[model samples]
Target: MTIDRPRSALMAVLLAALPAGCTPVATVGPSRPPLAVRGSTATVEIAPVLLAARDHFPDGAEVRNGGIPNLVGAAPVEGLGGGGAADVATHAETQALRYSVAHPDIRIILTVTEGLYRIVARRSAGIASVADLKGKRIAAIPTTSSGYFLARMLASQGLGLDDVEVVRVSPIETMAKELADRKVDAVAIWEPHADNALRALGTDAIELSGTSIYRERFNLNSTAAALADPARRARIVRFVRAVLAATAAIERDPRPAQALVAATGGFTADEVGRSWPHLAFPATLPGDLVDLLVDEEAWLAAQEKRPARERGELAKLIDSSVLEEALAPPR
Candidate 1:
C-alpha cells in the first residue's frame, strides 16, 4: 500500500527542517555508507527520526514500510492468514508487559513506543476509566492487538470477556458509527484510529483516558528477528535515533510535524496536536519491562499458544544494547 505522505513532500519538509547542527556537511568524521533496513512497523513511532537520520547520514539508510501489524503476526490486511515472516510478531508495548514463554525466536523492537489509551466513541458520557465499562457493550475485533489492549484494560477491572458484550468490528470508523447509533458504549483504539474515533464520535459521544494497568498491560516489544541479525540491529539503532530526533523536532515546533502526520493518513493536525502531549517518544528500553516481556512469553507458553521450543529461554530474547547506544549522548 502507498504511504500516506508522498515521497516528494516528506523529503522536502524533512530536508528543509534540517538544522545546521543536524546537517550532514557539519560532521567532520569520514562518512560511512547508509544502512539498508527492512522490517515491519517494529520501529514506526520513530519514522521522523529515521527520516532525519537518512538526511544526516546521507549514506542511504532506507526503511521500507509494509504491514506493521504483520511484523508481530500476519499482516492485518492479509485477513486471518497466518504464515509469514511476521506471523510470530507481537506489539512491543503489550508484549513487553506480558509473558511469551514459548517463543524464543520472538524478538521485539520499541516500535510505536507508547502506552495504551482508551478513546471512546463520543456518546459515552463522563466515562473516565475502565471501571465505567463494567456492563457496557464495547466494539472491537479480537484479531488485532488493539483488541488485546482492550482485553487487558478489562482485565484490570477484574472483568473479562464474560463481563461485557463485545462486537466484532475492524475499523474505528465502523465502531464510531455504531456508537453514534447507540450500538456500542465505547471503542478502544490506538493512534491514527484514536484520532479517527475522536472525530467520528465527536467530544459529545466519546471519551479519552489512561488505562488502569499502566506499565504491565500496555507496553512495547519487537521481533526476535531483529535481535539475531547484527546488520538489522545496527540499522534499527540508527532508525531509533532518527525517530527520537524527529520527535524532538516535532514537539518543539508542531506545525510541519502535524502536516507530515496528516499527509500520511486520516489524522488531522488538530487531533495530532491534542494527542501529542500524551505520546511518549522514548528511545530507551527499561530493564524491568524487558523482564516483563520474558514473563509474558512464559505466560503465552503456559497457554499453549507459544511454540514449545521457546519456553525456558525468554531472557535471551532481548538485545537492548541498540536502544542504549541510541540513547547515548551524541558526539
Candidate 2:
C-alpha cells in the first residue's frame, strides 16, 4: 500500500528530519515548465548516457526531452513522466521522494549510472588529503549530487561544511576555470567536471578519490501517473530496454559512447575518455540502495535538525517493479 502525504505534511516531515546545524538548502527552480505528454510519446528529463540511448529506441517508444534538473524540480509541479541521471542522494531526488510520499504519483524506478565521486585539489594549495580542505575554499554546485558527495567525504574525514569556505559555482562548466584561475582551492564534483578541472590544472591537480565514502547512484525516476497508463508504461519499459542495450554497447566499446556523450555533454573527447573509466552503467537498483538512503537521510537529518525517518519509510521511495519486469525473461 502507498502512503499519500500532503505537501505540508511532507515539509513537516522533512523539517523534522533535519539534523541540528544543517540549514535547509534552497530549492531549485525548473528551467521551464514541465513537458506535456502527447499520446504514446512520453516526456522525460535525462542526461548523458540515457540521452544517447534515446536514439536507439525501437518504434512505438517515443521520448521527448526535458532539462535534466528541471525534470526533478518540475515533477511535483507539473507531473512529467520521469527524470533520469539524478543521484539518489541529491536534494532533487530527496525532494522528489518527499513529494512522492503524499502524492504517490511519482517514484524512482531504476539506477542508470554509478561512479566514483571525487574531490580535486590543487597541489599548489598545499592540500594533500580531505583534511587539508579545512579553512580552504572549495567549489561545488550545492544543489546537486556533487554537494552531497562533498558532505559525505568531509564527514568521513571528521570535517563539515563549516570547516571550509564554500565557493558556489553555476553552469558547472565554470568550476574547472575557477579552479585553474586560483579562485577555489579545490573542486568537489562528479565526472566530466572533475576531469575538466584536472585537465585544466594539468600537473597542478591532485585528485582525492574518496571511493570509500561515495558509490554514487544516478537514477531514473518516473511519475506514477505515467506508469499507470498502459501505453505509457509499455513505452517506458521499451525505453528501459533500450537503455540497457546502450549500456552493453557502451561497455563493449566505449569509443562510440564517448563520442556521443562528448558531443551532447559539451566535453572534449579527451575529457569524456578520462571520465569514462570511473562510470558504470547498470539497469537495476543496487541491493544496498535502501541502506544508503537510510544513512544519507540520517546525515541530512543531523545537518538540518530534522528527524531521521525509519528505514521502511525510506524504502517505500523506490518502486522496483518496473525494473524487475524489464529484467524478467519472457516465458
Candidate 3:
C-alpha cells in the first residue's frame, strides 16, 4: 500500500503538468454504503476509470476503494462480502472464472474492458519473439493475469513455464524495475506497467505482442448475497451504468480520463496516452465469454493437473442478465 518515493515524485510531476483547469486528484461520488470495489494498482480497469469519471456516477452512490496488489487469491473476492466490500473488479477473466468455480456464491456480473497483454524484453537479450524465451529469466506477477499471459505466450511457440526461468515479482512496479535493471530478460505484464517498462528501457525495449496468444477481459464480480439483495443489486446496476457512461466519455474525449489515471495510478500522462490504444472500454459482456472461460479452464486444468469443467458447468459462472437489464430501455 505504500507508494514508493520515485512513484510519488512521478505522480506529483504528472499532476503538476496537467492543464491549469484540470482537477489535481481523482474523485468519487457520495455513497449509500461503503461499496467495496477492488481494483489493481497497475491496470486501468473499470473501477479506476469509474472513479476517474466521478461525475458520471449516480447521485449518493459512494464507492470505497479496495486496491490490491493482484487478484490471484480468494481474499479479495471474499472481502466483497466478508470483508465489508460489495463489489470487486478483476483484471483477468481466468481469475473470475476461477472464483466462480471455487466460490459458487460469487457471480461475474459484468465485463468492463478488454485488451492485448504484452511480453516486453531487452532487445539485446535475443528475445525477439516468444520462441526466444527458452532458459531466459522472465519476470511476472505470479497467480495473476500476467502469469496466464506468460503461459499463453510460451504455448504459442510450443513452450511452457518450464521452458523459461520464472522470476516472480509483485505489485507490478518491481516488474518494470527488474526488466530495466537487466535482472530479468523479459516481463509478461499488462498496462500501464508494460508501458512503463517500454518507456524505461526506451531503445532497448522490445515488445512481443501477445495479440495472437492472449486478450484480456476485466470483469466486475460480486457475491451471490449482493446480487440477491434488492438494494445492493440496484446499486450494482447503477454502478455498471456509470461505468458504461464513463466508457463513452473516455471514447469521446480521453484527456480527462488519462489525466485521472495518471494521477491515481502513479503513471505519467504520456504513459497512459501511449498505452490507451491497446485497451477497449466496453460496458457489455462479450457473447463469447463462456467460450473464452472454457478455453482458459482447459488451459488451467492442463497446466495444474486439475479436472476440466464441462461447458454447461462453466456457463453458470457468467450472469449477463444484470448487464442486459442495465442496457435495456428504461420502462
Candidate 4:
C-alpha cells in the first residue's frame, strides 16, 4: 500500500519528540517454520499468522482461524473451541470472558499489540482536550479495544458517551472521510488509522494530541479459550508460546508484520511503519491495564449495545499461566 507523505513527515516529527531512546521499532527477521512442535491446536485472529504457520509447519498442524472485526463473532468461535474469545480489540479480554460464563469451557489468550491514542480535530479548531469534544460529532467504533480508552478520556473531564455525538463508522479509514467532509467534528483513533486519517485531511487540517488515556484506561488484546482438560490446556499453552514467538518476531522486525497485515487487507507497511512509533511492541500483558478491566467491564455493562457483565468477574476469565510457562526457557 502507498504510504501517506504528509502523515509520514508528521509522524517523524512526533517520533522525534518522544522521550529520548523510546523508539518502538522492533528488529524483525526472516519468516520460518514453527519453532515449537507441530500439530498444536490454537485459535488466532490475524489470518496471515495462520497462513504463515501453515507454511512454517506444512505438516499435521491444525490452526483454527477465528478473527472477527468485533468482539461479538469471537464469542461463538471461542465457545466452539472450548475457550473464550481471544479479543483483537483493545481492552476486549474481560468483555470476552463475560461471554464465556454461559460457555464455561471457553478461556482467553491475548496477543497484545502496542499503539497510542490521538484525539484529532480540525486544525485551527483549537480543540486541545477531550472536554472540547462536548456536543461535537466524533467518528469511531465502540469496541472492547477502545471502550475503556474513550471512557477514561471522557471521564477525565466529567464526560460520557452522552457528551458527544458519536457517529458509528466501521474503520478509521472510513471515519477519516467523514471527518474530512466535516461530517464529524472529531475522532479518536490509534496509529496507522490516525496516521492514515490525518493524511486524508492534510496534516494541518487536523490537530493531534496524545494522552495516557488509552494506556491508562484502554487495553487491546487477543485471547484463546481455556480448555477443561489440563492436558488440552497444556497443548493450548504450547500454541501460545508459538504465537508469542511470532509476535516477538513481528515486533523485532515489523516489515514482516506490516507486510502480513497489509496482505490481510488491514493496513499497509507505511501505515504500520507510521504507527510503529506510537505503538508498543511488548511481549507480555500489562497487569495494571488488565486490572483496570473491571472499570471497563462496568462501563460496557451499562451500555445497551454491550453484553451483560458481573463486577470483578472478569479476572477469572483470563488464563495467562500457559503463556507464563511457555515464555520460560525449556527445562
Candidate 2, residues 1-331, lDDT tens digits: the string is 0011123443344434434522122122344221122110110112333333334453322223332333334442232224442211112344444444445455667777776778998999999988899989999865456677888888888998889888888756689999999999999977777888988999999999878887777666666666777766665665666567777776677665555344333345576677777776776788988888887777666655667779887887788888877777743
Off by over 4 Å in 4: 1-65, 68-91, 94-98, 101-105, 124-126, 205-211, 216-226, 305-312
Estimate, for each residue in 173-252, the C-alpha lDDT of model 1 and write its tens digit.
46667776777777776554555566667656546464544432222244566555777666566556655666667657
State the lDDT at 107 in candidate 2.
66
Model 1 scores worst on lDDT over the 10 consecutive residues at 79-88
- For model 1 the TM-score comes to 0.66
How close is each model in CA RMSD to the real structure? 6.5, 13.0, 4.3, 9.6
Prediction 1 global C-alpha lDDT: 0.50
Stretches of candidate 2 off by over 4 Å are: 1-55, 60-104, 302-305
What TM-score fits each model? 0.66, 0.74, 0.84, 0.68
Error of 2 at 178 (Å): 1.1
TM-score of 2: 0.74
lDDT score at residue 35, model 3, on the 0-100 scale: 43
Q: Candidate 3 on 124-213: residue-level lDDT in tens?
A: 898787899999999885566778888888988899999899998754677888888899999888787788888889999888998877
